[model samples]
Target: MLSSTPLRWPGQARASVAMAFDLDGPTGAAMLDGSLWGKPEYFTFGGYGPYRALPRLLDMLEAHRTPATFFVPAWVVETWPRQCQAIVERGHEVAYHGYQHESFFTLTLAQQRAVMERSAAIFKRHLGLVASGFRTPSGDWHADTPALLLDCGVTYSSSMRGDDRPYFIDAGDASRRLVEIPGRWELDDYASLAYTRAPDYPAGLDRIASYDQTLDNWCREFDGTYREGLCMTTLLHPKISGKPGRIGVLEEFLVHMHSHADVWFATCNDIARFWAQEYADD
Candidate 1:
């Protein structure tokens, strides 16, 4: 059930919207490929995101003049410097996804720490960004995940679905709370759009959703979010939503959203900072 309580959006907007992308690229697939590293069959499937889909998606954002956040794996940033550079150059926010797309549940606390440290270093070295936001690759949240993000200076997390609007997690510390910008599977493209010969957990539906239906659902969700003055955070992947047809649907949604004069389109970090300043205890 969605919340009916209102939220205080920035700039007196009726509601807020965040367009975020998980640019996992080949890192995740390769990591999942185990010993078969560099095998084009599964590896190249992810490669398509950086090589083919990214530019198209970027151009679409540019055309819409919309600011977005791209959560990318450290390995992807390291592997495709130019594409990563392009993302930075375009004035979009780059936040941590992980070293690879490995789930925190599969790793020990120590392993998670190492991954964050290495990924943070990559963010600094390559993009000169000390990232303050994180989205887990698999949306896998362990008991220690919040504290781990806090230790890494990640003030905001976009992986949890505890609420329909932004809220704070205890962070295992009485004094400090972590801001959570919730995301739902209904707003993600992976389940409906992504497919593979050998299926994984989210095997992805056998058939891709038609463009009209996708746009309809997205707009319907946004309409409710706007009516209740809550935050709507959508999760997308370049590999899935960057298809020409899907991109068209996204553009249509943007157009419909833009028609509403009171909508505030912003990055996830911007929303988190706003909440910290406005809603956090002094």
Candidate 2:
């Protein structure tokens, strides 16, 4: 049996594209145990996202009149309220990532629930925003994740790679289901750009792949998804893609996309709500 019923996206567009950012900031790097906070280079590296890349990204998106989703860690939101606020002010969807980019596998179920509650509370109280969508920090989850998110009032999750289109998970409750937006490793920035000595992280490519090569890969995915009338969401990291050279690659892809009139640029929340209503079984 299928996890979710396959359905077309809203507006009859050729394909839907959700340009999402994981605004991790320094939270992931700094919050880790035994982090070199004394040297602070890692923290600075993540901080570059909001301090420099965010403004550039906002300008680029605004100039193109596109709305996007930003999955932010709670620590980042609390540390950089102004930047997080700017995202809300600019009319983008701010969704839950995690408290400090913590992997769900590392936490107990009760711990996971606490993380969700705290992040949601911070988003509401500090940013005046309530998020209905969630993307796990590590794109991995325990079996209970769907039901847990549903309990937290989350409507959609973008962490799974089960399909090219949106689907639903039963969440073990026949009455409630969670929408899965589906993300691919090939479409994520860390797949191409992240380099680390940390034992916990994956190794980057042999060398940073050229911008042209990466763009080609992304465009090819977009082209195929557009032809199939499916959803294609590109997961970007500000610290990685927000750089001068890499940002151009994204800009070029957007320019290419602008030529197509049939594409729908949407937020994950918008897509999830549409799917829930369109595919809901009575």
Candidate 3:
């Protein structure tokens, strides 16, 4: 039954997980001091606060020869088009992170569609890539988002916080274009940030989990997916993962990934395109 999943790569391809970065700049750090979901200082300060470690991050990833996808907000791209271009120029995939970084759950359906359209336009005109993927700001999406995303020409959305495996979403009639690449709540940097501990090293908690017990769950899911032929994904934020102190945990995890040969470390777009081609009739 598992091997029946057309999404699964051929052979023993253990779940090929893509590493991603939200790439919100220092402006988000400043916003931390402001009101966010009734919490002040939410993302206002930290390792990712916009000192622009992209160069360092690039160096680090280069050291490992790793390719990643960067989900960039339209405002961030407008703020740093050069940097955004550099990300593409350096070979990492770019996906939409909304226009304003506002949660879709908070917006009216029209507002959500407006933002989605704006985001797609920005990516296409500026980065010269037609971003077929979407990730909600704060990972919040209403049930109506899929329909609106289809209306906006989005082929897949990555805000799902459940199983790691990707699956086709029946958009009913609004649009059959949308697919779901399940995101994990346990593995995202945001989860670790909110995960309370006395020590409260929000950054370390996520990095630590990447290599520690948290990863066990990811592997279990990966093994299950590969054995049964499923799919999976992991999400990261540059503010958290790109930091020097925390990058070690991510580095360790990548090294661990290297041990597995069958896994396909591919871009989110690659997954979406392949699925559409292979299962369009299904």
| lDDT per model vs. reference | 0.85, 0.85, 0.66
lDDT of 2 by residue, 1-282 (tens): 233433466666777888889998877644766564764676687799988999899988998888899999998888889988999999999999999899888888899999999999999987997789999997788998899999998999999898988888989977879999998888888877776544334543456777788999888888888777788887898988988888898898888887799888988998888888977863
User: Which has the higher lDDT value, candidate number 2 or candidate number 3?
Assistant: 2
What is the clash count of model 2?
A: 1
How does residue 129 of candidate 2 score in lDDT?
75
Candidate 1 lDDT over residue span 66-180, tens digit each: 9899999998889887898898799888999988888878889999999999999998898888988999887877887898889889999999888888888887776768899
Ranking of predictions according to TM-score = 1, 2, 3
Q: Report the lDDT of model 1 for residue 21.
A: 93
Weakest 10 consecutive residues of candidate 2 by summed lDDT? 1-10
lDDT of 3 by residue, 1-282 (tens): 333444546454655666777776533323434433343334433224334566667767777777777778887787678778888888888888877577678789988888877877788788898877787767777777787787777788787765556667767663465777767755565654333232243545533443455455545555665565455566777676566766666676677676677777777877777667766666
Task: Give the Å shift of residue 243 in candidate 1.
Answer: 1.8
What RMSD does model 3 have? 4.5
Candidates ranked by lDDT: 1, 2, 3
Q: Quote each prediction's TM-score.
A: 0.94, 0.93, 0.79
In model 1, where do residues sit more than 4 Å from their true spots?
1-5, 33-39, 199-201
Model 3 is weakest, by summed lDDT over 10 consecutive residues, at: 192-201
